[model samples]
Target: MALVAVLILTLLSLGIALSGTLTRLLLVVVPYAVFTLFLAGVVYRILKWARAPVPFRIPTTCGQEKSLAWIKTSPLESPPCLWGVIGRMALEVLLFRSLFRNTRLDMGQNRPVYPSAKWLWFFGLTFHWSLLIIVLRHLRFFIEPIGPCITALSSLDGFFEIGVPTLYLSDAAMLAGITFLFLRRLIVPQVRYISLFTDYFSLLLILGVVTTGLIMRHFFPADLLQVKNLALGWVTFSPFVPQGVGTLFTMHLCFVFTLLVFFPMSKLMHAGGVFLSPTRNLANDSRIRRHVNPWNAPVKVHTYEEYEDEFRAQMKTAGIPVEKE
Candidate 1:
């Protein structure tokens, strides 16, 4: 149903673009609406999270902590300072360091056991890096006189010189990575059981967007200047509809806009949430110092000695160690 919805919506967008009835409406009104929703939604979500009290220094620790001068600590896993935290965040966001260490559980006879699940991480990294490259490569479409660095990047990306149109390695990598990710979700029993329709829908939507984009670039090329003008107009707050851009390009742009508009409201917000997460950002320093939650109310704690004192006679009769016995 989600896939069908995506197909229908994409086809509908294509129809609207082809109708030639309200080119200015989609070019101006739609971009403004989508941009506003994207901005407002993201700010609202981030603010909500910022206002929520964490109340504890529960940094997500996965390795040896900083303790006893003689023992070494995994700084990336349990950062004790800002520098370490920065490094940790870098690896986490860019390389998916934690996911790279992910393990899978499987039933062996009557027992359950964990096994390597690094393939998921591999594909995830590939997908993200390729997607980033692709987005960067797209700067050429939005900028006039395209910066030297972007031109260099474009040259490097299509260095293989695969064809007349010049195929990009990032494009192939992105598609392959997407395919691998989609298959992994289905092939892994645990992942498959935990996956929701939203997961499938997101994957399908991205794939559709990528496919349509590739089709536009290769099979049905459009006026690069016109597309760039449209993009620049949107950015400058003076959107204008450009002629010669195919309906397929419009549908692809719509899907990309949809993803951006829906991003903050969805689980995809985890990209930002991960940074704010106390568990992943806090230091494991409980052994060296106290971490008292300011919100915690004072309470009387019962001591072990008090319990022993109360049951001294009983403890002695039962042959248990009693201080008073």
Candidate 2:
């Protein structure tokens, strides 16, 4: 179903471009509209999360927490201070440190056994890095006089010099990573049982984008000058619609816009949401510091002696023993 949906989208894009009816809409309005939705949705989600009351320290910990002066603590696993939390977050964001410890559990002789499963972590890391590189490489189109860093990175990516246009390692790696991830969900019984349409849709959608992009780059070859002009013009608020950018580019752009629009509402929001995750960003310092909930209501307490004093007169009137009297 996901594949069919992607194909239909591709066909519709090609059909529209061939008809030359909505070229301006596809070229200008769609990009702007999608960008607006993406930005607004991300900001709204972030603000909503910011308003949520944590009320207390609840950082997830794995290793020894800081306690006695003589005891050694694992800062990366169980952060006790701000610096330690920063270090842990760095490792988590950059290296996927927690994912590195991914485990596969099985029942062996009535007892559960856990084995190392690092392939998910590896492919996940590969997909993210490759995607980042590809985005960085494409920055050349939007920025005038293309920065030296992007140029150097692009050169490095095509160092193998495989074809006329020089195949980018990131392109192949991204494809492979996506393939593995998608296949794992379909082939693994545990994952397949839990998988939803959205999971499959996201992967197939990206696959469509990459496939169309690769075809344009290698087979048809989009007009670089026209493409760059369009990208820059859009970025600079002066829209430019150039002819002969090819229907394939249009399809690719559609897929990208769809992804951008879907990003904030989907699980892809994790890209920004990770920074705000209390379990990840907060330090495990419940032992050393107190976290009083400022929202708690204050109340007055009456002691047992006060209660007895107030009841003593009533007790005497009723002929009961009164401690106060």
Candidate 3:
């Protein structure tokens, strides 16, 4: 199903590009209009979620929180204060810090689900960092004359200078990581059943984006200058739709736009929602004071006198304490 969907999308996009019926003006107009809707939807959803009331301080704790004066606390794991929470969030966003400590267990014969899995942390780290680098490097496309920062990143990324077209570490790492993640889903029975169309679709979309991009660059080379010109014009609002840009590029661009449009509506909103989540952002000070839900409803209560009135004889016979005889 996932493959069929992608193929259908690819064919449709190629047809659109080849039609020549959709004018340059319309193609240029459509992407930006879609981008606007995408941006608006993202902002609206985020704001709506942010307004939800979290009545209780319910930050998730994995390690020792601030308790006794003598006991040391794991500030990063179980943040007890605001600063600690910020630090934890930073690490999580930038480095996928918590995932570094991830562990997996497997069931064994005559024993509990009691054994090991390989180093998922390393692969996860490699993939994320490489993706970040790739995103940063692409900054050159949307900017005029390309900033020195981008130049520096390009230099550092291809510092090895191995061949005619210098090798990028990110290209290899991204492929390896995507392959592992996909395999992990297919090979693991539990994950395979639980996986939905969206999960598979998202993976395929990203893989297609990366594969098509690589092919465009290393194999069937497109004019980088023209590509950059088109990107910059789009970014600057003085849009220019260039000719001779291949169908593959259009399909890739459409997928990118599709991902962006789908992002806020899907689980990908976790990127922003993470910041607003009480589970990650709140201080864990449960030991320091009490927290009561302000929105809790009033409940009927029976006083001691009423209790005594109801069971006075029984209480006296049983020799139980009574406020009044």
Candidate 4:
């Protein structure tokens, strides 16, 4: 139901833009507003997480602690220092090391077996990396005299030379990855049971965007120069809806705008939240250093000496040995 609603909304938006009823509004105002909202929302979320105080050393450990000199410790698994934490975070962000080690349980004849879920990790990694490449490939539209790095990446992505307008591998990989992920949620009973409407909605929305983009790229073509001009205009703050940019492009932009507006508010913000996760970012140094709670309140403590002094008279009356005597 949620996926259907999102798809309808996207299609409706495209219809409105295609009808030329809100060309300027869709092209200029919507994009600008969405971008502003995306920035503000992301900032707000990060600041909220930043203000949260972690009063204890609670880094999730998966390996031996740093104790005896002879015993080897896995620095990346159970980070004991800042450098180890950084390295672990790098692997998590770049390669999704933790997810790569994900395990799935299977039950057979009243016994359970754990197996590595490498396929999920592979699809997830491919989806993210391909999406990133596609986004970077778009930098050519926004920037003037596109850098060598972007050019090199674009060349490599489109190396197949299958069609007249060379097809990029990232597009296919992204689509395949997304489809597999969506199907996985539906096919797997456990996953499907746990899945929320937003999960399906997000996947469908991204798939819609990618499909529309592919259509514009191959089937119903748009003027690349005009699209670039429009992008440049937006960046320059002198926004202009370029001529010859068809309804398909407008639809594509609408999907992108919707994504931007929804990103921070949705589970997609995990992209940023990963960096703030206490378990992943903090060093496992509880044994090495004492962690004092910054918000701890002052409390009056009764000393053993005070207790002994108070009981001295009672002890003497009972003919008991007293410290004072």
Candidate 5:
């Protein structure tokens, strides 16, 4: 669900293991295999997308396009240049500009009224950002000499200073976001009608992962030294399961692995897909430049001159006017 951020968790969960052979298989071999599968699958999908042909400039323009010199154009919406397209893509990718602009149509007394429904965007953004932060925080385990930036981020995320373990704002935000999104599917008539099993499954997977992780951190703490060593061992290509890491963490880990293995084949690939999409990546200069289909075969045209030459004898016999006599 969180995309490539799952890479960090694969390292973190190296300590959650079973018996001798099973421990090596689950904690060590499984992480490597799943991560490998995730990476390969994602790359194959992206490359497949890249190979697909775009026949025309079909950018999803939202404003005035570049035409006459005097006409004002919305650069962000109808991006006409490379820089404008890049800027538009940056905003859409980082801030979800298009989603932020989402509107909902409401039937007033007898008329239609379009209103802002920003809560969906807000919750979606919150969930994703929090997930990203949590994933980044786990990098402290993988890297021996942890970067200052990672430490700073972790400190900032848990700066509330609420409890003995220090409650993380990201944890709270992620839980609230996931709950709101899940409830929306159940409560909203339109959303409920369209929601699929996969949609609910994804949310539940993330919720399960977050719930189990929170339990491990607060209620039943994992041995930090062993966990860190296991993580570092993964980083160094030598892995061993450390004893005393509970089954709860293992359960939490299975959820992460499920999400990872499911990610490349599922809708979660939108993280990678958004970049390859012609509608988002292309510049809106359709009127200015002709986008001939690259796949078109070479076409031969019979020139009027050639036709005139070929029919000259017939034209002369028929007493018809001819370009050349």
Candidate 6:
């Protein structure tokens, strides 16, 4: 349902743009608005997370701590210091180390056994890395006089030379990864039970974007010069909706705009949130240092002396020992 809705919306957008009435609006104003929203939303979320107080060092530990000298400590797993924390965060951000180490439990002969979930990790890694590459590959469209590095990256991505236009491997990998991820949510009973409309919506939206992009690249083949001109105009702040750009291109842009607007408001904000997560970012140093809650309030208290003084007469009558006496 989510997929159908997004696809319909995208096609509707294409139709609206193709009518030529909203060409300027769709190509110029909408992109500007979406970009502004994306920037503002990302900043707001990051600042919100930054202002949140984490009074304790509560990094999630998965290995041995820095205790005895003879015992080995897993610096990445149970980070005990600032350097260790940096290394851990680096691994998490760059390689998704935690996801790579993910395991699944299965029942066999009435006993549970842990098994490596490498396929999930592979798909996850492929999805993220390929997405990054694709985004970078798009720099050619936005930048005038494309850099050698971008050219090199593009060459590396299309190294397989599979087709007439030289199909990039990242595109296929991205599609495969996204398909697997969506299927996992749908096919797995436990996952399906917990899945929300938003979860499926996000996946479907991305899939729509990828599919439209692939169509434009392989099947329809939009005029690259016109597309680049549109991109360059937007980047330079002198926005102009280029003539002769196809409906598929417009639909692709619509999907991208939708994604940008939806990104910060959805689970996709994990891209930035991961850095702010106390569980992933903090050092596991509770054993080495005492952490006090900075937000703790001061309060008036009744001392033992005050209590003894107040109860002195009652204590005398009851023959109870009193500190005052």
Go through the candidates in order and give each one's C-alpha lDDT.
0.83, 0.90, 0.80, 0.88, 0.85, 0.90
Span of ten consecutive residues with least summed lDDT in model 2: 14-23
**By the lDDT metric, which is better: model 1 or model 2?**
2
**In candidate 3, what are the lDDT values of residues 1-325, reduced to their tens digit?**
8778888877777777677655364448877977897899889988997899999988988899898889998998898888999999998888777776665656568665733344566777777788788899988888877889989988988888866577687887888887777777788898899988887777777777788877777777777787888888888888877876776677677677777777767776777888988898899988887988889899799988998999999999999988887
lDDT of 5 by residue, 167-242 (tens): 8999999999999999999899999899877787777778879988898889988888888998888878998878
TM-score for candidate 1, please give it.
0.87
Among all windows of 10 consecutive residues in model 4, the one with the lowest summed lDDT is: 12-21
Candidate 1 lDDT over residue span 208-251, tens digit each:
88998998889898777788888998777777778768878877
Weakest 10 consecutive residues of candidate 1 by summed lDDT: 19-28
- lDDT preference between candidates 1 and 4, better one: 4
**Which segments of candidate 1 are over 4 A away from where they belong?**
109-111, 298-325
Of the two candidates 1 and 3, the one with more favorable TM-score, higher being better, is 1
Query: Candidate 4: which stretches are off by over 4 Å?
Result: 305-325
For model 2, how does the per-residue alpha-carbon lDDT over 1-325 read when each residue is reduced to its tens digit? 8778878888888886786658888787778888999999999999999888888888899999999989998988899999999999989888888999999998989999999999999999999999999999999999989999999999999999999889999999999999999999999999999998888889988888899899998899899999999999899988867987988888888889888888888888888888899998899999898888888898688987898888888878889886766
Q: Is candidate 2 or candidate 4 better by lDDT?
A: 2
How many Å off is the CA of 51 in candidate 4?
1.4
Q: Please provide TM-scores, in order, for all candidate models, with all chains considered together.
A: 0.87, 0.91, 0.85, 0.93, 0.89, 0.90
Instruction: Report RMSD (Å) for each prediction in the order shown.
Output: 6.0, 3.2, 4.3, 1.9, 4.6, 3.3
lDDT of 4 by residue, 1-325 (tens): 9677776877787686667548777877777898899999999999999889888888898999787789999888899999999999999989999999899998967999898889999999999999999999999999999999999999999998879688999999999999999999999999999999889878878987898899999999999999888889899998876675887888888778888888898999999999999988899988888888888899798886788798888878898886666
lDDT accuracy of residue 141 in candidate 1:
72
Query: Model 6: clashing residue pairs?
Result: none
Give the Å error, residue 144, model 1.
3.0
lDDT of 6 by residue, 260-309 (tens): 99999999999999999999888887878888898879879999899999
lDDT of 6: 0.90
